[model samples]
Target: MVADQFGLRAIPTVYFLQQGQPIDGFQGPQSEKFIREILTHILQTAEELKIAQATELMATGKTAEALPLLKEAHQLEPKNSDISLTYAEALITLNQLDESQKILNTIAIQDQDSRYQGLLAQIELQKKAADTPEIKQLQETFAQQPENAELAVQLALKLHEVNRNEEALEILLTFLKKDLSAGDGSVKKTMMDILSALGSSDPLTNRYRHQIYSILY
Candidate 1:
């Protein structure tokens, strides 16, 4: 039954998987050299493997899906500038200007290569646009009326306009944490909208969805 489920037909059919998906397969006997190459590709260091996966995600415009893997790779090996740069690049894609800048800042003077500079430049340019007058004004007013749910929603809307998604989501989540049913469920609704905008594949969507489920269930 299992062999049929996996579509195995030949006696020596074999499949190799990475991250739970089949990446390579051979239906008949293979040369030792070819088999060794497959083993080597699958046996790479965890950090590099993550970076490779993250690179593919970023290349395909799946920034949200790529971010957690890159972050994990960074945590596993902080000294590897390649991982840090990949993580930073994802942050830039998500318009996480502050976090991306912080990561770029960690690179040593010698390791401040072209990729680091490019990410840094992107953050600087985006940060300037992000520090707009409307956001500034809304942030100031929201800071003063920290408990006002209406004001919180207003500011979150502004943050969402410029693609500061994580920041906007964080602001909404904070209020939701305080009062899950605040504003007659409008607060939760706003969070749902943010998650929807973040896409179903996003790690943030899954993480935040679980958080909301935990509170309700």
Candidate 2:
């Protein structure tokens, strides 16, 4: 069967097959380092073959096998966003939402401001609407990371949703004062948004408004 893959028209003259197998085959999983150091060259050559095979598998609805092959290709070349995206899709199709989300999250965090990460964050936010375990876990983690402006902003938004305006305002202001300087004005805009959300056109809003005006003017 393997010989047929090489387009061998007839029996080989003085055939010397390894264990009656024409193709060199691996029996079991190998270490990541071994695959990276030695098999990378071989994997690069095999990628086109793997993609062809995986496409056939997917066409035949054998997505389970196709997913692993795609994932393997991704491991071989992590920069291949298409492979990573396809693997994430396959995982979703297989009802592996957690794994898919985790992969997307890693991709997003590693490549800040990527469209992939933005999509992942949107998906996470949608899922978080029901107050899932993931959302709760993220909130807990964000609370521990006092220096993370993004997380603070996210948590502040969540707090505002529950009408915890005071807490949200405090968190947002602290984030602005500590991380985002007055010169940047992003934190001031955030403060205005939070104040508007809370229906507070008070002295604080005027102060932030003045700050925003100063930054722009």
Candidate 3:
């Protein structure tokens, strides 16, 4: 009736129907740019809503539930690195290292950002004590990426595992002198562990020997 009254031959219409009632409609297909602008606005609104819900869940100590929502939002927008990284972090907080490592590994491969690379290094180090070829392979894989404080520490720890304290000392000392806050405190803690493992009697150990002595004594 409206189209006939407007003397339109053909009218394109968009309808938002709710329970068979037309709640909203657009008269015609908009231009590509206008449609894209509308879609972008809708997507941003959805992302914000999901982020707010996830944050609420996390605050309420329902991280388990929050994780899946965050994962969905991330899947909806894989280009959002923060969402991906936050999902990995939430998984870590939930003590799901395997899942977290999987996400982190993807980011490390795609982004190769220092933060993601450092995380992969830390995860590998956690598995360093395993007496298997896999641990060695993991270390070698990480060595190919850009070096960070944590990577340096993990490489040092791997070197020490092969009974090369001098090289490990170099890595640990180098990490200690840098701004490693982006990589968490794992680098510093690993340095301590390496110093303890190296023992005070080793010549390369002299640099941190006093600090080690204070800690153990």
Candidate 4:
């Protein structure tokens, strides 16, 4: 039955399922850690779907509607970093900065994940948007020298400061596409920083991450 239902071709096939739907599986024996990771991933995926739905609602200016979804997702996967970040973002959108910061502070300092750092940066930028003069200066420089990679990185960071994340990502992506073979990894690193800020489950992040992987491998 397992072979027929799951297309198992080997003797030691295993399947992981949730609500009767197959999430992941292996065709051979695996380490305990590997199996644990797969199980964790399955749980994470369930929460990710809720976050995606919440994001779509937010994109339509339905922040109030998105909140319940995010809260439910967070509750379902309390240990998931990505879901927690998205939940905090939704709180930010609702002008609940104190609540947002509390969530951000809970994330461990040693994690050092780009997404976590990016969210922290976002909160800071939102708190001091009026006090940042560098943003204006970078904008002017980027306007004058659109092809300068360094300026582009600086400008994109400024744009992200103002929550113009899509524009920021586009700027980095354009530069990376043109300088794919450049010895310096600055462009790629900048792209990853933006992607990590955008969150791992974001479609744009996934798309560009795949593009980078294709180029490197």
Candidate 5:
């Protein structure tokens, strides 16, 4: 069962089991340094266990419960990006955008991975959603000139400013269908921005992205 579960195909396959579950494994000979690093990671200390527990809580939609655990873990490992990112996510979910941004900004630009960028985009989107006057003005202008392509693009930006992302994308899509080469690629850029802010997994983003691909090709 162990061999089958671990998919051991070679003669000297090694499986690192933690609590009867395969956490890490190697199929062949590895250097001492590589083996050491793997072992160090696999063997979690008390603080690591706490962070793991917090991560599970967050995954299960228990951010309130996870926040304290993550805070403790962060205190223990202040520079750990994993903990910081999770904590920032929790804060974002709780509507503590300022605090989340502060934590995110502490992460060095060189260390800003995709997750960091995603969180930052989320924060910016949230901030944009709060700009009521600009959004209202754009909405009024767009309503007055619904057929104007430039107004449509500006209105889409206004919609995105207020978290009406689907509406924003639809506006852009309508304009692009009529003029795929609009705004010297500014239309495509706006669409891409909305898609990026929505993240790659969003169904609407996927749909519109497919449309964009068809238009481009």
Candidate 6:
């Protein structure tokens, strides 16, 4: 009856239940050590679990998805260098360069490992990428013709090319505020593209999307 209730079909089944509901489980004959390890993990604190999950997300190149989790984990464990490094990495991926540098700089000297050095190098690269002469030229052109929807969209597109997505979206949204369907909706189209490129998991993407909604409704 117990097996039937859970719909058990395997001979060796393990289930970790919390609050009368299963939170994790595995099926198969396993060593006692493996089972003990699973139990140990199940007993870990929320902060530990969050950092572990965020690390996995970061490993999979889902930095946007990991950012919030890592941010929470960092808040929970401010003194933890590993968590700080990960949060900084996620920030860099999202182009929050200054914030990322600040976080990285706070790590203790003894805890500054290879990962810390790598993040520093990454910050420099991102800074250099965000300052190309062409982007400057576009900025100048856009400034001279701020009301030109076509020029605004063109400059925004150029910004997007260099991973400056937030700025790209801002330029487009600024134009959209004055003329929602600028250049036959090309401006909104570009905004959508920038947001999409930022990924659904990115907070800025969500925020800007809400701004777009406000413009529409």
- Which structure among the candidates has the greatest lDDT? 6
Runs in model 6 with CA error above 4 Å? 1-43, 56-65, 71-85, 93-124
Model 3 collision count: 0
Root-mean-square deviation per candidate: 9.8, 16.7, 17.4, 17.0, 15.6, 10.0
Clashes of each: 0, 0, 0, 0, 0, 0
Q: After superposition, which runs of candidate 4 have C-alpha atoms over 4 Å from their true positions?
A: 1-133, 181-183, 214-217
Compared with the true structure, model 5 gives a TM-score of 0.45
Worst 10 residues of 2 by lDDT: 8-17
Ranking by lDDT: 6, 1, 5, 4, 3, 2
* Residue-wise C-alpha lDDT for candidate 5, range 110-154, written one tens digit per residue: 779999999999988876766588777887887888777777778
Which 10-residue span in candidate 3 carries the lowest summed lDDT? 126-135
**CA lDDT for candidate 5:** 0.78
Report the candidate with higher TM-score, 3 versus 5. Answer: 5
**lDDT string, candidate 3, 81-197, tens digits:** 777777777765654455677677566356767767666665566445433574466567667863566566667676667554545665565555554442586766776687776
lDDT of 2: 0.59
Which digits, one per residue and each the tens of the lDDT, describe model 1 over residues 84-197? Answer: 888888888887676787788888788998878888888888878887898899899988988888778878878878877677778888888888987677778888998898
Pick the TM-score winner: 6
How does each model score on TM-score? 0.61, 0.33, 0.37, 0.40, 0.45, 0.62
List lDDT for all candidates, in order.
0.82, 0.59, 0.63, 0.74, 0.78, 0.85
Candidate 2, residue 125: the lDDT equals: 57
Off by over 4 Å in 1: 1-78, 98-114, 210-214
Compare candidates 2 and 6 on TM-score and give the better one. 6
Whole-structure CA lDDT of model 4: 0.74
Error of 5 at 118 (Å): 0.9
TM-score-sorted candidate list, best first: 6, 1, 5, 4, 3, 2
